[model samples]
Target chain A: MKGPAISIQDLHVSYYGNEAVKGVSLSVETGNLVGIIGPNGAGKSTFLKAMLNLIPKDKGDVKVMGRTIKEVRKRIAYVPQRNDIDWDFPITVLDAVLIGTYPHLKLFRRPKKKDKEWAMQCLQRVGMQDFSKRQIGELSGGQQQRVFLARALAQQADLFFLDEPFVGVDVSSEETIVKILKELCRQGKTVIVVHHDLSKANDYFNQLILLNKELIGFGTVEEVFKPEVIKKAYKGQFAFMNEIGVSL
Target chain B: MAFIEAVMQYGFLQKALLTSVMVGIICGVIGCFIILRGMALMGDAISHAVLPGVAISYMLGINFFFGAVFSGVLTAIAIGFVSQNSRIKHDTSIGIMFTAAFASGIIIITMLKSSTDLYHILFGNVLAVRSSDMWITLGISLIVIAAVYLFYKELLVTSFDETMAAAYGLPVRFIHYFLMTLLTMVTVASLQTVGIVLVVAMLITPAAAAYLLTERLWVMIFLAAGIGVVSSIVGLYFSFTYNLASGATIVMAATSIFVLVFLFSPKHGLVWKTLRVKKKRASLV
Candidate 1:
C-alpha cells in the first residue's frame, strides 16, 4: 500500500498476432495527475485496459497500491471512452452517478440516501449537480462526459482510469473535467487520463507517459516532453506540431 | 356484457385471464432490460427455442413447463457460447439455434401427437387453461418481480454499460446468464397464453412502447407493465367474445399500443416532434 500507486512491468498485448502494446513498464506514484499521450493507435488505451485487466495481456504484471487488481478492485474507478456505452439509455444523471457506490454496497443492496448525498457531491464537484434530474441522452457531449466523471468520483476511488475523456467533448466541459481531476490529485488520489491533445499535455499533468506501442518516455513533463521524444514516438511525423506550435 | 359475464361465470375463463395478465406483467418488466441490452433477437430465439421442450414434455408425459424452461435455457446458453467462442455474431447464432430447435420441436410434436395439439402449442388456447398451469405462471411471475426489485441497480448498470459494471467487479457474465434464465422462465410461463411464436411480442412491444414514454427505467418498467396488462385484458376480451386465436390477439394488441406510442408519446413521438417543429416555425413568423 505504500509503494507506487500503479506499477506495470513489461506489459504486452496483441490482436490477431499483431502487437498492440509491446513491453510497457512504468511506475506511477500516488497523488499525481498523470497523462498517457501518443499518436492515434499507439495502444495508449490498450495499455490502460491491459493494466486494468479489462482485456487479456499476453504478458505483464500490474500492481495498484502494492496489491493485485483482483484484490483491490473496489478501490479503483474507470471512466471508459465516450463511445463505449449507450448514451440513449434511460438513466438519469444522478442514477448514473449512483453506480459509483455499487462496488461498496453489499449484493442486492440499493444505494442508501447517504450514498445519494455523496453522489450528489461528486456531481457538484464537476459542476453538474444542476443536471442530476435530467436524462443522460439529453445532455451535450461535454455534459455526458462530466456525468461519467461524476460517476467515477462517486466510487471515491484511490486510483482513477479515464480513457479519452475529452474526445467529442465541448471545450468548457473539458476545462471543467481537467480542473476536477487536478483537484482529485491534490486530495491524494491518483488520476490517469488517456489524452490526445499534445498542446494541453504540459499544462494538464505533472507526470507524463509518452507511449507508442511501447514506453518511449516516462517521467516529469520537463524530462519527457521534448520534441525529440515526441518525434520518436510519432515516428517523426511532427508536422502536426508545426500546426499547434507544440506549446512548449 | 357477455365477456364480463363469461369471466365471472366460468372458472376456466378466470384462470385464463389471470395467467395472461401474469405473463403480460413479467414480460413487460423483463423486456425493459432485454431491449435496453439490445437483446430483442435473443428474446425471440428463446421463445421459439422452448418448442422442443414442450414436445419432449409431451413425449415423456410430464409437465411441459420444466421441459420448456430447460430447452429455452439450453438454447440461450448455446447461442451465447457459439457467439462468444466464434466469429459468428449474436444474431447469426440466434438464427441458427432457434431454427434448429423449432424444426426439431415441430417434427417431434407432429410425430407424437396429432396436428391439433401442435396447433394449440403454436397458436395458444388460453380458454383451456388448467389449474396447475395457472399456478406455475404465478410462481414464475413472483420470482421475476422479486429478482428485478432486489437487483434493480445491478441490472440497470449492466444493461446500460457493461464495461463499467465489470470495472465495479460485478459478475458481468453471470448477470448476462441470469437474465437469460429469467427470460426463459418468462417465455415458458407465457406458453399457455401467447404461445412460443408470439411470446416475443409480449416480451418486446410493451417495453419498447414504455421506452418512448419515459427516460427513467423504473417509470419505463411500470409503464410497460401497465401496457402489457391492458393488452392482455383487451386481447382476452376480444378473443373470448369472437372465438379468435388468443396468441395472435394478444400480440396484435401489444403491437397496436406500440404504434400509438411511437406516433403520439410526448417526447420521443413523431407527433410531438412535428408539433415542436411547427411551433418553432410559427414563432419565427
Candidate 2:
C-alpha cells in the first residue's frame, strides 16, 4: 500500500561544463526523513537543484508521489542555504513568508486575505510570529533561518527539500528545524534534507543517502553508516571521528 | 508686473509645473527601490539610452514619446538578457549598452541635421514641458505606483534574495523583469523634467538621503518623495531667478540636499556623528 514519495531514475546533472551527478538513481518513501550527507563539492546541492528543476538535468526522470515533477510541483517546497541570501534587502519577515503563496496566485493577482492568514500561521509554527513585522535585515542569523523555515512551511507541501538548512544555524534554530522536520514526517510528509554534519545524521534522520559525486550508499541509517561507507563518502580528507566523534 | 503676470499666467507654465511635480513624485517613489536594488547605475544608462529612440523617431517623423518608450524598453530587456547570459559583469554590460545608445543618438541627430539642440535632450528645458508630456508622465506614474504597491512583498523578496525566493517558488524571473520594466518607464517619463544627465541625481539623491535616516522601505519612499518635491520647487525658483537651466538646477538642488543629509543626519550621518563621538571620548577622558 505504501509507495515512494520521491523517485529519481538515472539522474544526470552538469554544471557550466563538467558533469556533477551521473546516473544516480534513488527513491525516498513517504513519511520518511532522509538525510543526504556528502563532503564538499560532492553534488549534494546539485542533486537538490536538479530535483527542483532549478537546473536542467542532462538526463533523468524525477517524480513526486508516483507523478512526474510537473504534475506535483505545487506540492513540493524547498529551503536553500541561508548564506545564499542578501541580508540587506528591504522586506519584513511576514513579507518574506508571504512569497510562498505566490506560485498559487493568479497572474497579476495580489495576495488574498486567506493567503495572509496561512502565512501568519506558518510563521507562528516556526515561532517567528513575534518578529513578523520586523525587517528581515534586523534579524539574527538563527532568526533568519527560522523565517526561511516559516516560508517553506507556508507552502503547505507534502514533500520538502531542504539544502543545508542547518549549515549556519545556531543551536536553537537547528533544534527548532529538526523538530519541525520530524513533525512533518510524523504527519506523513516526505522530508529530504542535504546535511553535512556526520555526528547528528543518525539522530535526526531515519534513512541516509551518502554521496561523494556518486551514490555511495542509500538505506536505513544503521545499514548505511558503516565505517567503509563513511570513509568512501568523506574521502578521509580529515579525521572526522576524532574531531567530532564517531560517525552517525 | 505685467511681464511677470504674463509668464506666470501662461498655460504651458501651468502644465510644466504640474508635469514636474508628477515626474518628481514618481521618480522619488520608484528611485528608492532602484537605489536599494543597486541599480542606480543601470537607471543612469537606461535614461541615456532613450535618446537614440528620440532622435530616430524625429528622423522618421514619428511620435517622439513612442520612440523613446520603444527604445528604452528594448534596451532594458537587452541589458537584462545579456547581463544574465554573457560572461561580462552587469556593470560592464550596462556601460557597453550606454555608450552604444548614446553614440547612436549623437550620430542620428548629426545625420538628421535637426535644429533641436542637444541641451534640450541632455539638460531638458522644464519651461518647455507641455500638456501632452504631463499627461504621459501622470499616466505612467500612476501605473508604476499601483504595480509597486500591489506587489511590494514579491518585489522586495526577489530583490533581496533571488535564489532563495526562486526556491520558495516566487517567480523571481518574472518579478525581476517587471521591476526593470517599471524602472525604464519611470526614467523615460522623467526625461522631460530632469533630462538624462541630471535625472539620476533626482533618482538617486532622495533615496540615498532617506537611506541614512531609516532602514524601513515604506518610510524611505515617503521621505524621499517629500525631499524630491521640495528640491524640485526650490530648484525651479533658483533657475527662474538666476536665469539658469531649470533641469540642471533641480538636479543640483537634490544633490545639495544629499550633501546636507550626509553631513547632518543623526545616525550614520557623516558630520554630526563624528563630532558626537569626539565629544563623548573627550568627556570620558
Candidate 3:
C-alpha cells in the first residue's frame, strides 16, 4: 500500500519471435485514472495483458500493491474488449455480473443470496438493474458495456483494467462509464484503460501513458501530453491536434 | 401399450433400454457444453478415435472401455498440441488425428484375424450388452453426471470465456483437459449403445436441438436431456418393431427431432422467422 499501485520493470513480450512490447517499464500510483494511448498494434493492450499475466510474457516483473499479481488477483478486475466477448453466449445480465464473485467463492460453492444481492447493487450502480434478467445478446451496445462495468463493480477491486471500454458504446453510456471510473478513482482505486482516441484522452484520464512498442511518455497529462510526445507516438499524424489548439 | 408390453418382456431388451437411456442422459448433458463451445467436431473426432483403443484393448485381453477412453483422451491432447504448436487450425488437427486413429483401428481389427465381431463395435449391438457392461456404463454415467453437477459454474464460465476464467485463477487448462477426459469417458460409455459411428449424433443433435429452444444454459441442458431420453425410447421402440439397427435408429430419431426444432421452434426456427417477416410485410402493405 505504500508503493505504487502497479509497478512494472523491463517488460518484454513476443509473438512468434517478434517483439510486441519492448523493454517497457512504468509504474502507476494508487487512485489515478490512467490512459494508455497508442495506434493500432502498438502493444498497448499487450502491456496490460502481460502485466495481468493473461498472456505469456518473455521477460517482465510486475507487482500490484507491493505483491505479485497472482497473490492479489482477487483485488483486481479486468473488462476485456467488447469483441473478446461472445454476444450469443446463453447467460443473463445478472449471471454475467455474478461471475465477478467466482474468485471469492470456493470451487464447488454456488453464489449465495448475499452474492446475488451484492451483484444487484453493482448492477444498480451502472443503471443496469432493470436489465438483470434480460439475455446478454438482447441488450444494446451501451447496455452491454454497462453490464460489464457492473460486473467489475461487483468485484469491488482495488485495481481495474478496461480494454477499449468506450468502443461501440453510446454517448450517454460513454459519459456514464467515465463518470463511474472517476468515482472509482476518487475512492482510492487505480483504473487503467487502453484508449485509442487521443482527442478525449486529456479530458478522460488524469495520467497519460503514450506507448508504441516501447515507452514514449509516462506522466501526468500536463507533462506527457507534449506535442513532441504525441508526434513521436503517432508518427506526426497527431501534430494537427496541437496546431488546431484543441488543448490536448 | 401392447408394443410396450411386448418389448418389456425380454431381459436383453430391458437391459438395452436402460443402457440407452443412461447413455442418452450423459451424452445430452455433456453435449450441451460440447456444442455450445463449438466443439461438435471434436466430439466426432474423439468418438471416432476410440475405435483403435477398443481394437487394441481386445487384442490385449483388457477392458475395452478403459482402452477406448484412454485413446479418446490421447486424441484430445494430441489435437490440442498439434494446433497449439503448428500453424494448422484446430479443425484440421482434429481431422488429421481422428482419421489416422480410425484408420489404424481398422487396420488393427483386420490384422487380428479373431472372432471379435468388429461389426458390433462399429455399428453397436445394444441388445447384446451384458450385465457387466451395464454396470460399467452406470458407473461412468454417474461419474460424468456428478462431475457436471459439481463443476457446472466453472464449466460454464470456462466455456463462455476462457480468458476471464484464467484471470479469476480457475485453472483453465486443467478444467479444459478435465472436460476432455469427461468427454472421453462419455464417449466410451456410450459405445455399447450408439456405437462409434453414431455416437457423435447422440453427443450433438439433442443438445443442439435444446440450444435452439432455450435462452438459458440450465434450461438448455435439461431440454437436451429430455430430448435425448425421448429419442432413445422412441428409437428403441422403432428398432424393436422394425428389426432395425438400434444405433442407426437412435441417431435418426435424434436427427428427426433436431429437424423439427430447426424448422418449427417458436423463437429461433426458420419457419417462424420467415412467417414473422411475411406478416410484417403484409402489415406494411
Best by DockQ: 1
Q: Residue A92 deviation, candidate 2, in Å?
A: 2.7
TM-score each candidate: 0.96, 0.88, 0.96
**Each predicted complex: what DockQ?**
0.79, 0.38, 0.70
Candidate 3 residues lying further than 4 Å off, grouped into runs, are: A236-248, B114-116
Per-residue lDDT tens digits for candidate 3, residues B173-216, read 89888998999888888888888889999999999999889888
Q: Worst lDDT window (10 residues) for model 1 chain B? A: B113-122
Return the candidate ranking by TM-score, descending.
Answer: 3, 1, 2
Q: How much lDDT does candidate 3 score?
A: 0.90
For model 1, residues B95-180, the per-residue Cα lDDT tens digits are 99999999999999889856888888888889898999999999999999999999888898899888888876888889998999
Docking class of 2: acceptable
Clashing pairs in 2: none
lDDT of 2 by residue, B14-118 (tens): 666677777778788888888878889988887888889999888788867778877777787777778778687889888888878888988888888764656
- Model 2, range A1-248, lDDT digits (tens) per residue? 36999889999997665889888899989999999998888999998888887888999998879987767777888887878776666567887888788767765687889999999999999899999888787898888988988888888888888888887678988899899999999999999999977878999999999988778999999999888788877766658565776543
Q: For candidate 3, write residues A78-169 as lDDT tens digits.
A: 99899888888878999999988888888789999999999999999999999999889999899999999998998889999999999999
lDDT of each: 0.91, 0.82, 0.90
Relative to the unseen true structure, what is the C-alpha lDDT of residue B263 in candidate 1, on a scale of 0 to 100?
A: 100
Candidate 2 shows a clash count of 0
